[model samples]
Target: NGKEIPYDPSALRKIREHPCYSENASHKFGRMHLAVAPDCNIQCNYCIRDFDCVNENRPGVCSSVLSPEEAIVLVREVMSKDSYVKVIGSDIFPISHPSGTIVKSKDSYIKVIGIAGPGDPLANDVTFETLRMLKEEFPVPLKCLSTNGLMLPEYIDLLDEYGVSNITVTCNAIDPAIGEKIYSYVEWEGEKLHGRKAAERLLAQQMKGIEMAVEHKMAVKINTVLIPGINDHHVVDVAKKMGEMGVYTFNIIPVIPLYKFADIIPPTLSDKKAMHDACAPFVRQMRHCERCRADAIGKLGKDVQEEIYRNRGSL
Candidate 1:
């Protein structure tokens, strides 16, 4: 985006290097997404969180879980090489593993470290711990995080302490009636909520969380999963709301029909482009989104999703 960044010197630098946050930077900058979060609080109708498959590509799929300690080792290695390399286990290999080929780059295209989960990053304690350890060990060039915004209000302070400068929140709907249609249940505060009640709580938190994140001065981006008949009309409303809250960017993600939403077809390119154009007036729209896997590495790399989906038959 060409808009002015209101952040101080340190925060501004993080946004500049962040590929997802900055359109121009993406072509020259790479990012590394660590799939360490193990669980999620809410269950979406389209979501199927799976692990150990090593053959599926999507948001909720990963080869294996990593301990905070293990995640640190990978980050350190990526930094040393000044490039993108995927590392799995103590035995780091340059090849793509069965779980997925994890690779690191050795160039000036600096990498932004982030956690996008097979589960929600905030739902896992290890996420915070990983960021904490990273901050202490070295001067983190640009740390980012992607979450559902369910736990943002509660953990915004911790994010500040751990140095998460860029955050992406997935907000599907602002209305509970629409939300209930998208999500099955939301596990909040030790209670499993269903239907409208669940959607109500989830939307409330999402709105509040986005507001809080903006106030914290973190570069905020809103990701809305475009479900044709579901939230299609309401995507603009969500964007207008995020725009009011001072969000930096808006990403309209095309839904991959799965689980309960398997019957629905994904939006065509024209449909998606229409939605993007509609939402652009309210907030700056992301030019291109690979809608990457939780473990996908590089600058919005196209490597992971293609490999995993094509080889699922081998499993």
Candidate 2:
């Protein structure tokens, strides 16, 4: 009788429907990410927003930016053409029976709409407006967003009011010393912070945000980039802290060697496995992350902007 019970049935349904949360749902449901937020508040060493490389498939790469109205139109078009069509012909052409009947085939539909950034979603106002509009117009889809966690504490109440149940916060290190090595600077409350000062402020906000998200009864996921010689040694500590705060899942992703981190090698598969094993006792691990692009669409590994382009033809 001491076991914790979920108060919201809708939350359970959302978890089940989200491919990122359930492995079985990955094959059944699809997701669409709109690249509405194109500005970032923090400067991560591994991130390079200036150049676009086709070989890379991680975040901060988007084909183009869309206004809120353009994004809404795109979502509507995607929802409309997500299925296949079949036409049947009748020989008699009677008054009661139509000459032909058009039937649509069942196909994977976009059940989740997320803004995963060309930059941090919370850094841009368009992200909030876009989500608010989606909540008002199309309430069936589950709403989610990923952030750097700098602005998360201030935005949690608004996110809850907008019906965003899923939130992901990227926490690289619990220790500010290690965090300083990863992040170059952060824009906080109109002030620019650098080095250890930035790292300390970021960690404090991230911890506060995770706690507040749990307090609001929102499903929270922690995304940690495993950078060797950096935050790699500290992931388990981050996991332990998150587990105590009631985080839903821990996603330990290998850092994409880019920009300032180009010299740092990516983690080996064995290293990833070891990290997962170490954290397994404390929190559930998400092993199927695709490290999707900002404008990623369709299923996990099968995400393609071409599908969205095809839908845009209708608009």
Candidate 2 backbone clash number? 0
User: What's the CA error at residue 213 for candidate 2, in Å?
Assistant: 0.9
Give residue 29's error in model 1 in angstroms: 0.7
Number of clashes recorded per candidate: 11, 0
lDDT of 1 by residue, 1-315 (tens): 899967463247666787777776776677766778878898888877663111113544444667889777756655665223334432233333555544443434445777887688999899988898889985557788888888989999999888888888999998899999998999988899999999999989888888888888888888888898999989999989888889988888888888888889989888989988998888888867776766665556534323432433222
**Whole-model lDDT per candidate:** 0.74, 0.78
Enumerate residue pairs that collide in model 2: none
Assess candidate 1 and give its lDDT: 0.74
Mind giving the per-residue lDDT tens digits that candidate 2 earns over 1-315? 899985752359667888787777776677788878878899889888763211123745455878889889877766664332111231111122244554432333567898887778899999989988999998888898888899999999999999998888999999999999989999988999999999999999999999999898778888988999988778999999899889888888888888889999999888998999999999888888787777777777766465446534532
